[model samples]
Target chain A: MTVPISYYVVLSGLIFLIGLVGVLTRRNIIIILLSIELMLNATNINFVAFSAYLGNLSGQVFVFFALTVAAAEVAVGLAIIIALYRHTPSINVDDFRLLKW
Target chain B: MDSLIFFYFAGIILVTATLVVALRNPIYSALSLLVMFFHVAGLYVTLHAEFLAAIQIIVYAGAILVLYLFVVMLLNVKREERIHRQSLVAVLLGATLLTEAALLVFQSKGPVFPDATSSGSAGEVTGNTESIGQVLYSTYLFPFEVASLILLVAMVGAVILSKKGLLDQKS
Candidate 1:
């Protein structure tokens, strides 16, 4: 009754692509951050799927580390976004032009 | 039966993920992200990584999504100010990635360890959590500690980055 591994891979791939599209197209920094989370979730699914199919626990362990890092990433990213919004009054990606020289 | 359940969850995940990206309102996008997280957790359950599933629900669905909602509210973004300017480029890049993934999937025979069912040596451990903990605390202990340090640094960095008047006061 187990699902084939290919199905899981395909699903993760599609999700990754969707997230990529969101990251590239969305102007809102917050939405772009959300897209990055989606991409990370897709990766987590891949890790869990491989772990389950291989009967290995290491992949799941890696997932734990990834989740931790993701949380940290979001915290810092949001803080920076808020800071940028405070400075520029906008969260649009194009509005972030301070670095442009 | 299992495949059916997996597809159902995966379908919902994909749909909601799309909604998270496509919706104009950030609040709607956050809500759809919440749905996506739950569906992903369901996928984790199907994978027999129940501990990861629970962690996913707690950390991702509960904490992470709530954080997103809070930011959305705090920012008070009325609506997306403009249409996506790079839609064409995004679609092209996404297509390239999808094609690469498809090729990899079709070319590979199957699971990397075809004969592997379970590592079986973990008999004393009751569940996936115990098995992972065994390795995490032993061989992976250094990296685990390092991860904690990274989190601490990130926390401090975030506070410094977000705090107002501190830099001005110092200067």
Candidate 2:
């Protein structure tokens, strides 16, 4: 028999949790972005898994849209990081405290 | 046999995902993410989404990751400090969420749909790529167009945001 859907869910959940922890606890902006990517990939896994199990193409279609969104997000995010670095010459989140109270 | 292959891919995906977060160097983190991407593609193939598996490699490993590396090298970011000050709280929150998710997943009887391999009906007769392309182009045309628009906006935004002296000149 094929692998159960629960197994995929569990795997996706663990990956998502790891990504969340990375986002919350990491200090570097680049690493933070990478963590965000992790989170995106986790969701993608879940989507594809459900799509295959359900015999539906909609889920895969959604994943395609999600990928497009993810690409855009990375482009804009890295650009923002570059601009921030130009101004302050640092990638550390702690250094960016102007918005923080 | 199927379960064995699934486990192999799952184990590597989990470990490399962790390394992507835990590695000290950004370059190392990106490399681990690259490895993770490949394994994920493998998982996609096992799940019968060959098109997605290919896209996963070409877009994620080939394009997006290279951009990350280019930026990392451009900035020459140094190793970060230990961790965020609120890491203890964050870890606690993550653990709680994990437990809740596990409970929910196990509590359910199982998935409502039939397994992909067992099911041989609509959407299975045609090849994966053909069916996905047909649906994407016809049924999901509107969203597809919107996605292209989003990419255009992001491209313009990135160019404007990263260009030197643009804002200064405007002011």
In terms of TM-score, the best-performing candidate is 2
lDDT of 1 by residue, A1-101 (tens): 26777788888988988898788778899999999999999999999887776666778888999999999999899988887777777878887776799
Candidate 2 stretches with Cα past 4 Å from truth are B115-120, B166-171
Which predicted model would earn the best DockQ? 2
The CAPRI category of model 2 is: medium
In model 1, the fraction of reference contacts reproduced equals 0.60
Model 2 has an lDDT value of: 0.88
- lDDT of model 1 at position B48: 77
Residue B11, model 2: Cα distance from true site in angstroms = 0.7
True-vs-predicted CA distance for residue A31, candidate 1, Å: 0.4
Residue-level lDDT of model 2, residues A3-89, one tens digit each, is: 898789889988998898788778899999999999999999999888888778888889889999999999999999998887778
The candidate 2 chain B region of ten consecutive residues with least summed lDDT is: B118-127
Task: State every prediction's TM-score relative to the real structure.
Answer: 0.89, 0.92
Candidate 1 deviant stretches above 4 angstroms: B81-112, B115-127, B166-171
How big is the positional error of residue A68 in model 2, measured in Å on the Cα after superposition? 0.6
